[model samples]
Target: MTFKKINENEQQNIHDRSCMILVNFNSKELAAIKTVSGFAGIRDRIAVTSKNGNTKIKDILDGNMVDDNEDVWSEKAIIFNNIPTNRVTGFLDGLKKMKIRRPLTAMVTEVSIDWKLNTLIYNLKEERKAIAKGQFVDHK
Candidate 1:
């Protein structure tokens, strides 16, 4: 097997990377999450916040909920607060596991939320964010 050459940045990132607090929802997604929850290293690597019906936005945002070792890509990962992390990661996992029979597509959006086309953005801070259901048509 040929050895792959890793750049310095890539090597540094790998050393710094850690487990994540993943969130998910929906039928297929929920199933995958349940599986991951039983992992022996679950507590050390991943945190599941949306297993129950009470998946709150703040729970993912709260630094206290996640371990310091879970900061994989960035410092603090505060920007991920807008994501419905449970649904996205879980859904993707279901796709990989071939358990979700429903057809899915890459609905491009930065934030994961059940969205309406005519939705209003009351928060100027949040206006830059995108909705999960969006196809990115005419989206800025």
Candidate 2:
């Protein structure tokens, strides 16, 4: 098999085509994010509900059909899949510049991809709490 090695920039470009999933955001907040995303050049996005909590991140990332019609905790949050490593700061900055309330943000990871949306949100809340306390590094 003749394999064409991808360069660093090429690999990054492949990963840069990202998708943003919004959870528990109101209409105004959704509009704000969609506007920001437009400026940031992230073309793909979706808003999901708690019912979607059980959907695997991988399925979402793969563009599989999402059935959020099913009834489904977290506050306003955003889950970023396949976002480029370097663009995170700029994206956040875009939100800050627009004076939009910051939502909890997470990038897709190997372990996280298997998690349902609700599971990710709950864990994110816990992690945030841990970081806020002095006991974030519990040795136990």
Candidate 3:
């Protein structure tokens, strides 16, 4: 078996690395994500949400989501961790080129990494509602 070598900079726990967590994506959408990620040379950085949909964000960011059986969720979402802005832009552009439906997306933040998956998704939906009503405020 061939093992990949990681440098000193990558010696930190998995949370330090870039990751993209997909939640509730159908087979076609999951395939698209894999294709786009591979094209971006970040295929190893992709993950999927756990079947229970209650995994901690930090754990998800650490590539710890492991559900052997396929599960379903009402709304599809994507969460990104530690990815550079340019690469995120490129990934989104790639998705557009593939003609995939847009998924609710968010970047991991210091405050959000500790939240559970369901909690984060709830907040994101609320934020979207606020924005739709022109009541959204940027706290950052």
What TM-score would each prediction reach against the true structure? 0.24, 0.75, 0.74
Identify the runs in model 3 with alpha carbons over 4 angstroms from their true place: 1-14, 63-73, 137-140
Question: What would you estimate as the lDDT of candidate 2?
Answer: 0.67
Of 1 and 2, the candidate ranking higher by lDDT: 2
Which stretches in model 1 have alpha-carbon errors above 4 Å? 1-15, 24-44, 50-63, 66-94, 101-140
Model 2 vs truth, CA RMSD: 7.9
Model 3: lDDT to the true structure: 0.66
Candidate 3 per-residue lDDT over residues 1-140, each given as its tens digit: 11121111122233576777788776877877999977766655454554645677887665576464343457778776766666666787788899887777777767677877777777777776676786754432
Highest-TM-score candidate: 2
Best of the candidates, lDDT: 2
- The global Cα lDDT (0 to 1) of model 1 is 0.29
CA lDDT of 105 in candidate 1? 23
2 or 3, greater by lDDT: 2
The whole-model lDDT of each prediction reads: 0.29, 0.67, 0.66
RMSD of each: 13.5, 7.9, 9.4
| Candidate achieving higher TM-score, 1 or 3 | 3
